[model samples]
Target chain A: MPEQLVFAMEVTLNGLMAGVLYALVALGFVLIYKASGIFNYAQGVMALFAAMTLVGIMNGQVPFAHLINAIFGTHVHEFGWSVPGFVAILLTLAVMVLLAWAVQRFVMRHLVGQEPIILFMATIGLAFFLEGVADLMWGSEIKTLDVGLPQGINLWIDETTFQIFDYGFFIDNLDIVATLIAALLVIALVAFSQYTKQGRAMRAVADDHQAALSVGISLNFIWVMVWSVAGFVALVAGIMWGTKSGVQFSLSLIALKALPVLMLGGFTSIPGAIVGGLIIGVGEKLFEFALGPALGGATENWFAYVLALIFLVFRPQGLFGEKIIERV
Target chain B: MLDAAQTTDVQAETLLEVNNIEVIYNHVILVLKGVSLTVPKGGITALLGGNGAGKTTTLKAVSNLLHSERGEVTKGSIRYRGESIHASDPADLVEKGVIQVMEGRHCFEHLTVEENLLTGAYTRKDGNAAIQQDLDLVYNYFPRLKERRRSQAGYTSGGEQQMVAMGRALMSRPETILLDEPSMGLAPQLVEEIFGIVKDLNEKEGVSFLLAEQNTNVALRFAHYGYILESGRVVMDGPAAELRENPDVKEFYLGMSDEGRKSFRDVRSYRRRKRWL
Candidate 1:
């Protein structure tokens, strides 16, 4: 087998792993967008905050200790013990929920019915505010997340022999776990939106705010519910990415990649976000593999944007977006 | 003016009273100038007017869609069931059994026919069984909706969408349904069909109706009471049958003379010629 083919296979595998992470972040965006028409640009920062909070809590940070003392008013350090992985995950989810509820009540509720662009800009401000808050509370330092996800590459098939067969493939167990988690989250979100009463109310609010109000669905309640749901999703994405590459400000940049995924998938479609993430992931990897040397290397930086720009020109309604019909 | 004794006799069965309500849009333009009318309970009331005669604005004010910031009832008040609902929210109005089937038949285009109907029961504090029963009732009234239960509303025809909109309002189980131009932009035959359904819904279900329409003949024929609005003011008010016979209303609105028809045709053709240029 040729060295070129091995390089291509490696890049493809790597790209797909990154894409799964992108899809996770995009899922958070879709949840907020569907429940509220506002584009939540603060999603990246939310992920950062959730991850930072998780690390702070796990490491016996003073502010996390102070927050616990203030709320439960019990002086505690590092939860006084080490909990199981699942228990820690559940505890982190509770914190995310409280954070989401606070943001919606204090920030988003007052900004209701404003222009979408204004809301989008407000989220940008929120992102910066949250980043500063996280930095203040936890101190701006990269931390290692130990949620007990398996580490190190476990290559099932030998690359050298597979390369000899001229059809080489390398698969990592961690990458496979990420793919499975991404798939599970997508299924859960779709089911929640379709089968749950609150989910239906969210969709109704997304379609028409006035109509939703007329039907006695409380807009504020739905907003809080969706924000919390999105926050939970961000926590999951943060954990996955943080575990894979360590928790830091760079994880926030990974969340930013969701913007182009949203552009390609259409902000309203959940499945579109997942598929768009996969496409961006695989496409960027292949592009970097095929054209990296020609473009002086590292074409992956702008590949998602280029693909999204091309899609916008041709299929602006996106993969699963409803076609808008103008009536006189 | 009718004597106070006669007005009291008329007001005894009134369900809705709009008393000298002056609505100003943007605190600048007075859209409804001292508009007043009475809609008797358990009967159809026709608010006859041409375009921009403040008919739609009056309906919106009653529904509480008009905010004081954008538009306000500057002078008077609106009473539903003898209680002033001047500053009530639209959702509160629905809860209180007053629902509006808006002018444009604002159906949720993305939802299926059944889903749209389910939305109408949003305010009801009933179990699934009751909602299902009401859903069945709506289907019985508009069988076409039942036939297309799984179809998205965007694919439905204008007439069918109108039925869906009406059915959605009916699902709310309102005591009084305010319909704004149910006949707008429909075929003549479809318009008659819709009007027939409205009459049936009113008589069979005991739902009172206050309809605003430009088509005077159809409205006057079905309504029991009528208020003729000219330039945001009620110019004439009487029983529907009597107003149908009034000479001025007949000449200007309902029963146009042959010469008036000729002038109407001449104006239409002149507009067509201008479009050709």
Candidate 2:
């Protein structure tokens, strides 16, 4: 087995892992886009805020510390400041839910019946606001997140030597876990959209806001629920990426990859996001590995956008978008 | 041929009563000025007028679709089943068996025919079984819709889309349905077919209807009672048969003279051809 083939296989697997993360972010974009026509450019910042909030809560930051100190004062520090990872995760989720509710109640509620472009700009405003809030709360420094997931590789075959008729491929356990988690989340989302009353209402709102309101579905409640669910997906993505690298503003930049994924997948498609993410992921990784040497080593930076641009020219409605026929 | 006792009984059950309602749009421009009418519990009721005669506004007021934002019902009240439903939400009105099929079909183009029907039943708490029963009922009334149940509504013809819209409203189990211009864009044959279904629904299922129409002759044929609006006011109101026989209405609207109708038709055809070319 050649070394180059093994390296290519490793890069492909790595790309799949990255693609799963992109899918998670794209899922958030799709959720918000489906419920409200807003593109929610702030989705990346929302994830950043959630991850930052988790870090702040875990480290006994000012607000949480002050609340605890006001109750118990001096003995608060002595009572073991470290919270369980699961508990911190849950608290972070609650905070995300509250933030989502507040965002809908205060920001989006007032902007109802506004133009789509105006709403998009409002989300951009929200993104900057959330980013500032996150920085103020957690400080603009990178933090290591230990979510109790196992680190390092667990190999099936010893020494990465697996030969299948003179072709060799390498596998990593982290890549395997990421794939499994992505698959599970996708399945859960599908079931929730298909079976639940709220899910149907979400789809209804997605189809037409006025009609949904006419049918008695609360637009506000659906918006909050979708944002909260998207927040949950972001938290999961943050944990995966944060554990792999570190929690920082960089995670927000990584989420920008979802835009291209959305372009390829169609803004309203759940399944399309996942598949598009994987394609972008693998394509970028393969490109960077095979062509990075000639391009001076960072082809990953623009690969997704290029693929999305090409897809736009061919399938403007997106891979899974409903065909719109103008009747005028 | 119907009995007098049955006529009295049917008249006694008043389905909708609009009492001196005045609707103003955008805090100015009165659309409906002290408009009032009553629809019996069975058979069709026609609201006839020119484009801005407030006929559509009157229907919107009944459905609560016209509020202060777009238009306000500033005076009087709308009572359904002896209850003042002036402030009722559109969906609540639907739940109470007062569904309005809007002026345009307004079918959810992205959804399949069956899915659009399901949306009509959004407020229904009944389990899937009851919904399925209603779906079957709707399918029986419009067999073409049943064949295209899985097809997206955007692809359906205007006539078929109107059926989907009416079928969707029926899915909510509305006792009294408000249909606004069901024959607006349909061909003459399709118009007759739609009116036939309306008659059938009223007779067979006992579903009450307050239908607003521009075509007086066709509406008078199906409706038991009718109202004529001339410039946002009811100029004439009476039994359908009585109104049909009125020389004044026939001369002005029904086009009793063939020469008058031929000129109108000729102008319409000329405009249509000009637009088409």
Candidate 3:
């Protein structure tokens, strides 16, 4: 292979891995939107909150520590004993589940049968509320998360590529893990949705609320279940992103990247999220590599949005979204 | 109001009773004004009305589906098997052997025909074998649904979608189905076919029906008893055979009269001459 071709292949490979992470975030949005009509604006902050909660649990930091310390002048922070990585992850998941129930009970329950736009506006309000709550619960401090996931370049890949093409391929172990995890997550989600009884009810509810209700499917329960699943996805995305870059307020901004992915993939699709993430990921990276120098570099930042904008005009349903079927 | 003469003929046990119900939407607009009806077990009762006559509202009120649309039964009580169900959840109503096949054939559009039917059995604690037996029963009633079993409900024809909706309600093993507008947007032949199935289900399966229909002609032929709703109130109630012969019904609804095919101009003055008013 030519050296330029090998370099392009590496960039594409990196982009694909990055796309998996984007798909991870997009999965959260898709899950909530699929089960309920609400487009959860709080999805990014959910990832941030889950990651912060995981970190706080692992470090044994007191929740609402700043307020507690300020109010009491007690200066008590950590419990002085860190939880194991697995245990912390489990604890964070439980908290996320609790959060899901609370969201459905307190916010979504009262807003049932409201207009979709109104539900969407509620999510925007929820986003700010959750963000404030997360900040208050886990003080606004950047924290490095180490969940035992492997990171850095794989030497085996480097050596194998060097031997095969006279050039070493750069591949991060973390990205490799993310790709594997994402593949498994997609498979699990597909299986759960395709075969399980609850999964069928969830899809039924997604299709028509009144019909689903008529069939005796509890909408509130399904909403909480979907939110919990989305919360779990957010936790996974949080773990991956928190490991890549320390857990911080900026961690939530990755959801903005997912917006283009969803726009390209369609809001009501799961496979679309994954495929859309990959397309945006590889397209942006390849675009920057091919045209960055000519365009004064940094084309990667705006490439996905431009491509998504073009997709919106032609095929608003995305690649795998269910086409709107209207009859006279 | 149901008189002793009307109630005396239907000696079968009452499956559902909606008493002098008043439905208000958004807490302001009164939609159902003191409507009352009865669904006798093993019988088909039709709630007949034109558009905006509160046919759907009366059915929703029975199935407790009014809450979702911001409509509430502000005054009356709905009872199923002698239990007050007006305030219960729609899901609970299904558990108590009642389900509503919503107007406009609200089949889960994304789901395949078979999957849509399976959703009907969501509340069933019975195993898959029993549910599958009922599934076969539904397919028997709607063999066309079996042929299009794998196809998406959204892509099916209007008549087939209506069948799918009715079949879905059947899968729930409902004792009383609050069917709303089953004949809407379907051909006359298909409408007759659906009514045939409803009659079969009522006779063989022993499922009671409180169906709302705008096709008064077909409804009167199929229903054992009927209620004529006009402007949110039941103006008349009688046996279907009697209702079909009633002069006012023959003129206004059946589009015929003793004078023979009265013109629209003459029927315009019906409100003043209507005996029930």
Candidate 4:
């Protein structure tokens, strides 16, 4: 293969990996959005919080220790004990589930029947609240998360491809792991929603709340269950992203990237989330590699949004969204 | 022909009883006022009315879908199998074998027809064998649904969507179904076809139905018992045969008087002759 061709292929491969991550974040949004019609702006922040909690648990950090010390002028940070990564993950999952329940019970329950835009704005408020709370609980400093996932380039892939040509496709083991995990998550979610009873209920709730209720599906229970699922998806996203760039405040900003993904894929579709993420991911990467230098570099920053905005004006229902047919 | 005020036949084996119910929407505007009806075990009962006459509201009240629209049963009680179900969750109703096919055929537009049927079975704890059997059974009744089982409900015709809704309710193994506007937005032939399937389901499956409809002629033709609703009140209740022959029902609802088609000039007499105030 030619050097430029190989390089482009490498960029495309990496873009696909990045797209998987974006889909992971968007899956959280889709879960909550499809089930409750709530555009959860706090999804990214929730990921940040989950990542921070995982790190804090693994390191045995005290909750709100920084705030306590700053206020009382006393130092009390670590608990002097380290928890196993696996144990910390389970504990963090429990916390996320609890947070989901609380959010649904307190914040969402009262806002039933509100307009979608209002609910969306409420999620923005939730994002700020969650960010502030997460910061207070585990301080805003960056923390490296080691969840035992493989790191660095896979030389085997590079060496084998290089044997056939010049410059073997360089690929990160983390990206491969993230890709495998993302595929598994999407498959599992698809199967769950398609084959399982609760999954069918979730889809039905997403379709029509009143109809689902008429068939004897609990609206409140479905809402809480979806939020919990969203939380779990957020945790998986956090783990992958945290491994790439540490757990920090910016971890939540990935939600911003995923919004365009949701728009391109349609907010209600899981497969669309994956496919849309891949498109944006590859498109942005290829654009940056081939055209970024000529266009002032860093075109990846706005490429996905511009693509989604243009896509929306032409096809508002999105790639897999139900056709928005209106009747008088 | 009897007067509209006449109440006839209260069966001892009634499965659902909506007794003197008054439904208020948004906590203020009253919709169903002192409306009472019953669904006998294994019988088709039609609640007939015109548009905005509270037929759908009455069904929603029975199915507990009222809260979603800010409507509630402010007066009287609804007893299902002799138990007060006013405060029960809608999901629990399905568990108890009561399902409502909503007005306008609220099929999950994004889902395949088969998937929509599966959703009706969500509350069922039966094994896959039975569920699959029921699925095939639904297919037997709604063969068009079987042909388009993989098609998205949104793309199907209105008649198909209505069949999907009914087929979905059947999958739950429901004892009673509250069918709202099964004839809406369909050809008269399709309406007759769907009602024929409903009749078959009732006869073979022993599923009781309380269908709310504005198609007075069709509803009364298929139902064993009929209630004529006007402005949220049940103005008349009688056996189907009696109501079909009632002069007032013919002139006012079925669009026919004793002299064939009643012209607009007889509208004042028809209004005066409506004995129920």
Candidate with top DockQ is: 3
Per-model tally of clashing residue pairs: 0, 0, 0, 1
For residues A58-176, what per-residue lDDT tens digits would candidate 4 score against the true structure? 99999999889989999999999999989999999999999988998988877766678988988999999999999899988999999899999899999987887767788899999
Candidate 2, residues B1-277, lDDT tens digits: the string is 2221125344358889999889888788988878889988875788987688888789889988665236788999999989999998877888888888877787777778888888888889989899999999999999999999989887899999999989988888888888899888889999999999998898889998898999888888888778988666788888777788786667666866444554566555544554311
In Å, residue B177's CA in model 2 sits off its true spot by 1.4
lDDT of 2 by residue, A127-236 (tens): 88988888766677798887777667655432444444243345556556777888999899988886676777787777776666555556778899999998898888
Query: Which candidate, 1 or 4, would have the higher TM-score against the true structure?
Result: 4
* Model 3 residue A258 distance off true place after TM-score fit, in angstroms: 0.4
For model 3 chain A, give the 10-residue run with minimal summed lDDT: A319-328
Number of the predicted model whose TM-score against the real structure is largest: 3
lDDT of 3 at A311: 92
- lDDT winner, 3 or 4: 3
* Candidate 4 to native Cα RMSD, angstroms: 3.3
Worst 10 residues of 2 chain B by lDDT: B1-10
DockQ of 3: 0.84
Model 3, A1-328: lDDT tens digits are 7788999999999999999999999999999888987899999999999999999999999999989999999898999999999999999999999999999999998887889999999989988999999999889989999999999999999999999999998999999999999999999998998899999999998889988988899999999999999999999999999999999999999999999999989998889999999999999999999999999999988998999899999999888888998887
Better of 1 and 3 by lDDT: 3
List, for all models, the DockQ compared with the true complex: 0.31, 0.33, 0.84, 0.58
Q: After superposition, how far is residue A295 of candidate 2 from its true place, in Å?
A: 2.1
Return the candidate ranking by lDDT, descending.
3, 4, 2, 1
What does the lDDT read for residue A309 in candidate 2? 94
**Cα miss at B221, model 4 (Å)?**
2.3
TM-score per candidate, chains pooled: 0.85, 0.87, 0.97, 0.91
Evaluated at residue A227, the lDDT of candidate 3 is 97
Candidate with the larger TM-score of 2 and 4: 4
lDDT of each: 0.80, 0.81, 0.91, 0.89
Write candidate 1's Cα lDDT for B1-277 as tens digits.
Answer: 1121133235447788899999998789999888898777777888998899888888888887666127788999899979999988777888888888878787777778887778788778878899899889988888888999999887898899899888888888888888999998999999988988988887789888999999998888888778888777887788877877776676667546544543666555544554311
